[model samples]
Target: MQRRDILKLGLGMAAVAWAGGAGRTWAAASGGSVAAGADTLDAAAWNAARQWTRTAFGRIAHVERGGGPAALFLHGFPLNGFQWRGALERLSAHRRCIAPDMLGLGYTEVAEGQGVTPADQVRMLADLLDRLGVENVDLVANDSGGAVAQLFAVAHPARVRSLLLTNCDAEIDCPPPALKPVIDLAREGRFVSEWLAPWQADHALARSPQGLGGMTFTHPHNPSDEAIDMYLRPLVDNAARTHAYAIGLDSNVLAGVEAALKQGRYPTRILWGTGDDIFSKASPDYLAGVFGDSRGVRRIDGAKLFWPEEFPDLVAEEARRLWGV
Candidate 1:
């Protein structure tokens, strides 16, 4: 048989299988239909962190599970708490895992006329921390969230117990070349309407390397459809939220953040995805220099932008050692 014939047969079988029994299992394992978001997570193995609280900012949404020292997870731009689902599940057994959908992302509702700048986010974080009844926390940060975490830790070192950093923006090259496309769109006021709207309309586009899924995880091709909707819709589909997030991204606001990391006092742990095309391999060391700590740098051999999603077990292991969980 020709190779094309064989490929056609395989596609036929896959479609047939998906139309029947195995598809159901895939859907269940992947958190149900594309709309379930984080709801369909298996409760037995997944701690299922869903809790909403009224904060001074608005009704903020967060994932909270387990009970011990507070371990707060911050997600990057264009994504939210959903990315930390696996880490939350793995570490919840020993520590309280709290992952929030920052200001305009996911289920975190941003109030009208609110700005989501890094400083604004830090203020929101403080308000949320106050409501969570915790004064200090072990913080884990990735991507744009890493910048936020750095600024927050530097400004309020008293609030952070330890910080675990993944691939993200450093002082030298903030967005990196590979990540500038989205930032560029935001600068022109065409992010939500042009970039995000089309991606949401086309599933394949959303999963392509040009979109969020491919930008996040590797090997698996793309994130489950549910994840995109949960993370993107809140910001990309809503004009207000999109505008809010874009405004924060449009400026050069990292001067204080750079100073903070260089001069701030905080315990730090470093995890970098060596295979990431966005943040270069030098990122981890650059971050270590910023934090003045080199003991905790560990590389995830082939993981990409969202390394935790690809290797949550490694993240959990490091968190266990770093936070003594």
Candidate 2:
């Protein structure tokens, strides 16, 4: 079947289930009681499981699961650690999974005057790991988080065991042209009130073609109502978060990191969604060429920018391959 057709079928099934009052919670085959949509975690559980750590950056919010070697998951722009809920559930058995909300985004309490650039995010992750007593970690990242992952690997090459990067900012397209309008809105400090506020008020609108679902998700109703609330509430609740997204995208933070990336020997794997329009198609190829220990790029047919949240199985599979687990 065509990808669009498959998506339609899934949406139809979900609608029918909702109409029939189907339960929202289910036991994942991998283990644990996951929320609807296969591997999702409900809002209440996600909120309750969060752990706060005090760092020089701020009071960082993160979720931890599993045991053994450490694996860190970085979420995309405007998203929190919740983006990796599915991957954490699946890969926790193999490695300790830790997903932290980036400063200025999610529920992380960022102190005033602190920067929210990719470089700053890299430093925040370093401090987070140090406080947690984790030395080296396998990195899994998507969207803008991918940019931070690159900076982290270069800044602390010894601390990265391997890298699994999905569609996001690369060296050439740090702030892709498609993001210019959003960046402009951020510059004006109107992104939260003008864009996210509507979505927070109307769940269906957020899932519509005009919002995040249409822009980044394969499924029209994806991110779910619960996820939409979880991801957007914090940003809209605070006025300070209005410009953070733009600051992070203001410049190409990955400009000079390519040379260092080529010199590093950390095993790397690139995953690109063919349907993503925000980033260049050549990016995955460019990244694969730059990494010294690249395992090549895997293209997900018809997937969009946020495919990591939709297809965590693929993320886990590639992570395991890169980690040689």
Candidate 3:
């Protein structure tokens, strides 16, 4: 019998640069190199999304745009930075929008045993910023990215100017109770091959409610073929990359996060969706109470897990309002 049958386990789930720097001209600063993308600050393009070698995790990839205040974007679990595409474009006019594929996800390369724990993720960002010569930034994070973003804010408050946390794992409800089954499979070390292979085989089925992870998003009745390929291409066929996805599932990131937020020195804004089934409303409520002083909390009615995908413009507007930019 094949290994697939041996274990009747359940299925599982889951830049750049710019000219017009120094607020005047593009000047490569210390830390990392910044490539010039365009001639004007308002017209900078982020579509190229570049990659660089990071001392911490081999090659790291990220998308960037514009100039002025820096806004760092973080993506979440089982998904790459692509989720922030629409939002990045929307915010590109005023902010230096940036989104990096976290640790082993997206097109970033990873060694077999590289650690992607929330702690490691924090260090990775700090190093990346140091390379890019970014002094501070507004953090816009969703899903699992929020978890790392929280830790990051606590560890390096000076680097983060503001925080915008969308639906994500908060407090102790991480992986959210709904996703515990999937998390369990990841922890068991069988999720990648057993669960994903079957799902990737049928792209349409993978996007259906009865499909692999179809239950995660509330809008976009069906995930576009492009979306599936963009998000899952690396993991579906590669066992090493698949294992990389499961690398630090047991870390309790929220243990220190709440205290950090209560004692936080930077402004924070919460944007939540009331329709999410994987992450609870309570998580956002707790975050709102803590980060409320910044801009209070704004909830999206009838939106689900991937509200950014459904309403990127709305998120961009709220971000603008929250930051007064």
The top-ranked prediction according to lDDT is 2
lDDT tens digits by residue: candidate 1, 247-288: 676454566465566665566888987767666677788778
TM-scores of the candidates are: 0.81, 0.89, 0.81
Q: Which tens-of-lDDT digit does each residue in 98-197 have in candidate 2?
A: 9999988889988777777788888999999999999999999988899999999999999998999999889899888777666767777777777788
Worst 10 residues of 2 by lDDT: 11-20
Worst lDDT 10-window in candidate 1: 9-18
Clashing pairs in 1: none
lDDT by candidate, in order shown:
0.67, 0.78, 0.66
- Pick the winner on TM-score between candidates 1 and 2: 2
lDDT at 111 for candidate 2? 71
The number of the candidate with the highest TM-score is 2
Q: What's model 1's overall lDDT? A: 0.67
Model 3, TM vs. native: 0.81
Best-to-worst TM-score order: 2, 3, 1
- Model 2 clashing residue pairs (backbone): none
